[model samples]
Target: MMVCRVFAIFFGNCLCLLLLLSSLADANQANIDCLKTFKSQVEDPNGYLSTWDFGNQTAQGFICKFAGVTCWHDDENRVFSIKISGFGLRGVFPQGFKLCSDLTGLDLSRNNFSGPLPSNISFLQLQHNQFTGTLPPQLAQLRRLKTFSVADNRLEGPIPKFNSAIITSESFANNLNLCGKPLDNCKMTSTNSHSKVVILAALGGFTVTAFVVGIVLGFFCSTISVEQLLFRKSRQNR
Candidate 1:
């Protein structure tokens, strides 16, 4: 009876440990999926991402072999950051980056990535890319952002307002059409204000002209009536 009890307790402990390990494995697989999705989105011309292979069990530790990938820990296998500078990649900002919930920092400078920057990415360094379009206001949601930069890109339109102090002139240097605080104060959009002013000025000028014409007509009629009365008196005297 004692032996049976000991065996039962040992079996239960083993089962519990197995369950814990299984959950962690599942989490690691999800991280792998996130990376796979991101890799599919980008166009790596120089084969910089060539080592990203998921075929062999030995390659399961993708964070170690993949270029610019950093994991949370050696055993965890969860991505922490990606700093792929000068990869010569071409594509829109990777929207799939949000899949890596554990991600903290990203640096993708000196690439040909076009389109808008992803709002989901906060702590980013995207300098010297071919990115175009307006800055997304959703970037303000990154409350934990510490360092941000996007200098020397082909981005246009107004830079989104951020409540963080990470943004500065250096972050927005060489971006021709990008304007806002810390840059050029964005050439205050005065189209609507100018239109309203023009309309009011035109109305005032019309009112003044009407008043002057009315006064001139009134004076002319009064003089003609006075002359007519004088003429009638002269005829009666004759």
Candidate 2:
């Protein structure tokens, strides 16, 4: 009958729609879980990230439009940036930040984050915070690390060495006890050894060069004197 056939088609379509929706929901929840890991790590004052709504049933909505979050063009479901600067969040680095694999920018400046930066995050823009600790060299491991700034913090010790052109001396300025290249008087511990080795090697080279020159000069003078004396004695005998 036509009526029976219509019901069957309608039910089948509904089932397919439910399954598709379920799959999307699962992926969204996974992304939320990743974001939730970083929630407790920071101190949110103005609650700029309050709208994150980690428990929301839909994950695509998060990437589509979330407070202080940005997503990539081709990947709407994947976060690419989190700019929460000047929001008065007081805390250390967030957790599971690396979970946002497509993240290209993270601006946590003007907060009260007080501690060493997260090692996995290389391109951080922490303009102002209460951060205090030695710049961890582990951050240097981020080969994609392009920009780093922790100005106006209590961070001290050597500014972590990075081989990237994106980092420069001024990036870590306004902090206390930071030292290394590009910044005058902030020599890093690693560079000191290199300088010492260079000085010692140069001194050793100079000493060797002088010894060789002296030996050559002495050999020529001694030979000339012996030859002259022998010639004079031969001439006198003749």
Candidate 3:
């Protein structure tokens, strides 16, 4: 009976270990799924990503050793960087990058991808692709961007606001109709105070107009009352 009990305990422990490993395996598969989704959306120039084989297993397989893909250090459960630029890729911008929360580097330059630029993609080499659209205002929220490039696309419009200082003037050139300081003379947008003042002035004008109309109406009524009283007295005298 003691031997049987020992065997059961060992089996239970092994089962627990297997469950833990399975959970980790699932997480790694999630990273691969995110990459696959991005591949479908972005147009690959020079067919750089055509060699990727997502069907393989993540561990002891070609997915882990896939070129241009660097997974997390100490573990293959997440992706770290994708530096494949100047490969002549052509397609629309990939919108599923938000799923890769741990991404640090993304090099998709010299590709033919076009879409509204930026949606909280905080990266260093994520630029240089063929993305075209109003500079997404959310890009200013990415606090980790460095050496960003969208300079040579069909992008246009006044530059949106952001908290980034690393970005330079060259990042936004050769566009359709971009106008601003250091480029053209599109007046920089006003601050919060300026917008508030404009709103207040419009409201104040309406209030003043209403007040003036009330005063004029009151004066006219007073004159009419006086005329009625005087007419009554004159008729009584007659």
> Any runs in candidate 2 off by more than 4 Å, and if so which?
1-30, 73-75, 186-238
* lDDT of candidate 3 over 46-82, digit per residue (tens): 6678777776554543444656777776446477877
Predicted structure with the largest TM-score when compared to the true one: 1
Model 1 agreement with the true structure over 36-135: per-residue lDDT tens digits = 8889999998999988877653444656568898998866668888899998999988877877777888898888888877666778999999887778
User: What are the Cα lDDT values of the candidates?
Assistant: 0.83, 0.75, 0.71
Worst 10 residues of 2 by lDDT: 55-64
Which structure is stronger by TM-score: 1 or 2? 1
Give the poorly placed runs of model 1, Cα more than 4 Å off.
Answer: 1-23, 57-60, 197-201, 208-238
Tens-digit lDDT track for model 2 on 122-195? 67898788888887888878887767888788888866667788787678888887887656665547788899
- Candidate 3 structure lDDT: 0.71
Q: What is the lDDT of candidate 1?
A: 0.83
TM-scores, one per candidate: 0.77, 0.62, 0.62
Candidate 3 deviant stretches above 4 angstroms: 1-23, 58-61, 74-77, 124-129, 181-238
User: In model 3, what is the error at residue 17, expressed in angstroms?
Assistant: 8.3
Per-residue error for 184 in candidate 1, Å, reads 1.6
Error of 1 at 72 (Å): 0.6
Error in Å for residue 189 of model 3: 11
